[model samples]
Target: MSPVVIPARIKKILIIKPSAFGDIIHSLPFLNAVKSTFPNARIDWVVAHGLHTFLEGHPMIDKLWVIKKDQWKKIGYLKSTLNEIFGLVKGLGKEKYDIAFDLSGILRSGLITLASKAYMKIGFEESDEGSPFFYTHKIKGGMDNHAIDRYLKLAGFIGCDTSSVNYPFAPFDNHSDICNILPPNYVVISPSAGKPANQWPAEKYGELASMLPLPSVVISSGADAAIAERVVKFSQGKALSIAGKTTLKGLMPIIKGARFFITNDTGPMHLAAALEVPVVAVFGPANPVRTGPYGSIHRVIQKKLPCSPCYAWQPCSHWRCMNELTVREVFDVVKEMTET
Candidate 1:
């Protein structure tokens, strides 16, 4: 495939992958390639407000444009939201980015691409919500590939080297306050998924945790604390709750401390994968090929059914895909991955 045309001098580069914890984590390798390829260029990123904390103080990225996405969606905040968006557009327009890659293939991201007036706006050809139309160059980011590889294809398209994939995470302190409360060594359980369809039952997680040799620390965002708490409740004192206690940055050390990670297709699962923490990723409707724990050291446990990879937004009435996936099945894999 012919590479996107390069400007004589590539100066300012923009990367648009605004939100979703896992998606942003997956983009780190792409960021690595871009920085390595254009070491001198000033690179900037557009990230969602709450999630921006994860990318905060990233040395690889020159600046962060925090988008108040949740507030933007509310009718009550329309005026402020518009003003914020307009200011963002106006500010980005002044940068005259030599190249911009919309890693996110949604209409909002597409609009950001248009607003930037990038010399070359790159996005996936199969991007949903007609996001492809805004791209000056559209690359076919194959659906079957892992999210990392799919993102790398775009890197390769823009002349960035994809041979070496590395996650450049922002620095986090292992000795922070949250870490003080954690057990000397424990397994991390991210007992929540953004979608109902992807989640393995919380009680199952507790069962798995109870059987594990190491103590388990259940974690989640403030909103998802109930799910984490449910897992802890089922662990019968074998697991403890650290949910809502740590920020995105603070959680890194906690995960790093884990001997292994057990999660139900959540963002932190990707984080653990990136951190080289052996992960037993439970899957249901979501395709592990596209978004499971990425590295080879990890194990993916799923109840194989023809309807799997359906990528359902909500669990079907029966929801056998997840319901039938027993705790023993997942625990055995975890033991195989960790004990062996």
Candidate 2:
């Protein structure tokens, strides 16, 4: 394969990274590199439904094409799903993009890349579900590298300066109404994880929250309301449950003003890290090296069990990785972070 050379007259580009909030956050630095290199380019992103709000008013992106991914997955909505897919392809075909990058290396994203009708399509060489077949250019995105670094490698392949990693998010306005309800100098605790194996017990989170120097504000999506309620209940009135209340945009200011954050390995964890809030993340099944808090200031608490970081699809029978991590251990780390 010949090296990817950015055309001097490059004008339009599309980035296809559809869903999963944390992965989208990981792609920001790559977006920054491309936008920095081609300051005048009209960069568009194909984001998934519900998750597009994070990048809705981002400075670097010119357009955000949202796809209804969840809606399309419903077996009952076959007709609408087909219509959406075909309509999206037809619309993308009309855009005439100069280049398209498939950062989300999956079959669906690969199809979107092909549909864009871009002259140059770039994707990972090791992309699963035969996603590489549609790529005009394939870059070796290593498996073991941190997600942010792996994405930057693609920027380097396209001759962008990858030396410095910058997350160029627009400043979020303070949700003063939300802030007014909470105690000053509060700590945000995000106890939900995508995988059950990655989650620390809600009772454990509550215990940790109760021990913190500041008041704890527990956040949760509508789907995780039960878990959030359990955390608040277990806190014995020490923590406040604001579950199902804030939108993605609303959550930022809450995190921004937070003294520090405590979370399971999840999307909000990445959000807190992006906001430069001090974070104490608890890791279990997943490898923190690849997807943990990125910066040096944040702290990660995980057990050193040999079977830890298993990355399992099913919940572990014992779940010792998270179960064994004591509330005292997490509380101690939070205390240390506050002092610093």
Candidate 3:
């Protein structure tokens, strides 16, 4: 059955997108689209705790309800979780929202939409049948389309021009005045991805670090300092690894000031692209079209093996596509992008 559209009189909205840092960042444009259409509408987002830091005080969002899943998933804490869930539901019910959007389109998002109990629930038509049952309207979304455009289409269906993708964090400067501390022309090298196969070789990153025209700093997950150590060792004094040194919030300022960024397809890669910094993003098993950095000053490297873009989350024993790429190829692309 086709989704039932609600009236334009709808003024309150609840949007749910829970995890996967890159996807959450990508969903920002959809939120902006809805805001553009209904400027006076009070928009609320349901997200995990740390993720809210990025969305702190967003003009498009009137409130952010942080959902702690781990706490809810604990065995002995079921009652506590229920209480928290009840409170969240009460808050949403109090808002008297006319429309709720399950942009995440996952089981978790579906549950959140149900909890909101809004009159009109919107989500992806391609989502699990059980999930869509909770939604009043469903927009088409999948691999053939860019994720950003797919989300925007949902807003468009509800009268949002959401024609443009906006990065709320790009214009908002929450950094210290120590912008002078950074080198005049520096390149940000993020040698990290959620999965190992998507990551370029540490030595290769080091080799590229040695070749780039400007000073370089390596970014990594604080929990995994060994990766940064390998990158530094391979770079032979050409790289400075800042793993375990900066919090997610602290790193944005560094990325914002960078002249350019080179990274494996990762969250920071998207962040850099959104910040309008030129990026040379390396891709392997993942489809760059659906999830690559979205910006004009960007280059995506994919070898296109018969098994290319497998989207495998686990470490691949033989990552042929990534292995085939040489440091020189990436350096050349960056040089070309920066020079012209």
Candidate 4:
């Protein structure tokens, strides 16, 4: 039997990606591509409340719907949370979305997809597991594709003709003074990772910061201030730690202006890669082959420990994978990236 042809009549689309900063960053190009293909379409995003800051003033997003997990998890908060969820569903229904894509492919997003009244609901196949079973159109063959490319392919199923994934970001206004302070040819050294297992030694990054000829800025999520402080201290006053100073939206302008970015395989690494900034990413625990920066102009440093890419639960005791990477090796890559 011939597959059912989804009506190309999709104008109002809801993109459901509700967690992880890096995954959302990876999805931005696909979102941008959707707008490029359907300029008239109203593109609404449903993301985690924590990441709402990143999309606050994005020109292409027609609406930003957020799900606050923390508030919803409290014992007495069920009624209010459900009401909020219902309100989101009603608001989404009023927009009359013709299509909703569950890009995050998780249970929470599955609930959101089920709640919405869009005619077409799409998500990943079941074998990916942990995925909610609410999609009307489930696309196979995503595991082999790069994460960004997978989103493009999903867009294709919706008639988006996503031939190219391009990300055009709006510069945040508040950081102009911060940008001025950075050297013209500086590299951003992002030393902290969300999980301890994925992080290289902060002392090593501080050591590397001191060796670099160009002035440097150290970045970390506000949650990792201790590590950020260590990098700043290790740089011996050569580096500025902007870890807790900038919100997600405010950091883009700083990243866009940097000459190069050195990071763990974290969200900003994906953002820098998406922005076309040169990147030197260090990888361990997670599979770099699956999630490393895609396209040219990016370099990755990884040691081939036999137990590397172990995908350990965070804060593993036996983390020689990332620990084996020395400051000197990462510095060599940073020098190469800056020179070329």
Clash count, one per candidate: 0, 0, 1, 0
TM-score of 1: 0.97
Could you give the C-alpha RMSD of every candidate to the true structure, in order shown? 1.2, 1.6, 2.5, 2.4
Candidate 4 all-Cα RMSD: 2.4
User: Positional deviation of 3 in candidate 4, in angstroms?
Assistant: 9.3
Flag regions of model 3 displaced more than 4 Å.
1-8, 74-80, 170-181
| Candidate 3 Cα lDDT to native | 0.80
lDDT of 2 by residue, 1-340 (tens): 3447677678999999997888988899999999988999999999998989888888899899998898877899899889989999998999999999999899999999999999999999999999999998898888888889888988888789988877777556777577789997788999988888888899999888777777899998989989998999888788998888988878988988888889999998988888899889999889988899889989999999999779975567888888788999988888887788
lDDT of 1 by residue, 151-229 (tens): 9998898788899879998877866787777789899999888999998889989888889999999999889899989
Q: TM-score of model 3 relative to the true fold?
A: 0.91
Could you tell which candidate, 1 or 2, scores higher by TM-score?
1
lDDT comparing candidate 1 with the true structure: 0.90
- Write the number of the candidate with greater TM-score, choosing between 1 and 4: 1
List residue ranges in candidate 1 displaced over 4 A: 5-8
- TM-score of every prediction relative to native: 0.97, 0.96, 0.91, 0.91
Best by lDDT: 1
- Looking at candidate 3, the ten consecutive residues that score lowest on lDDT are 170-179
| Candidate 4: residue 124 lDDT (0-100) | 73
Cα deviation of 33, candidate 4, in Å:
2.4
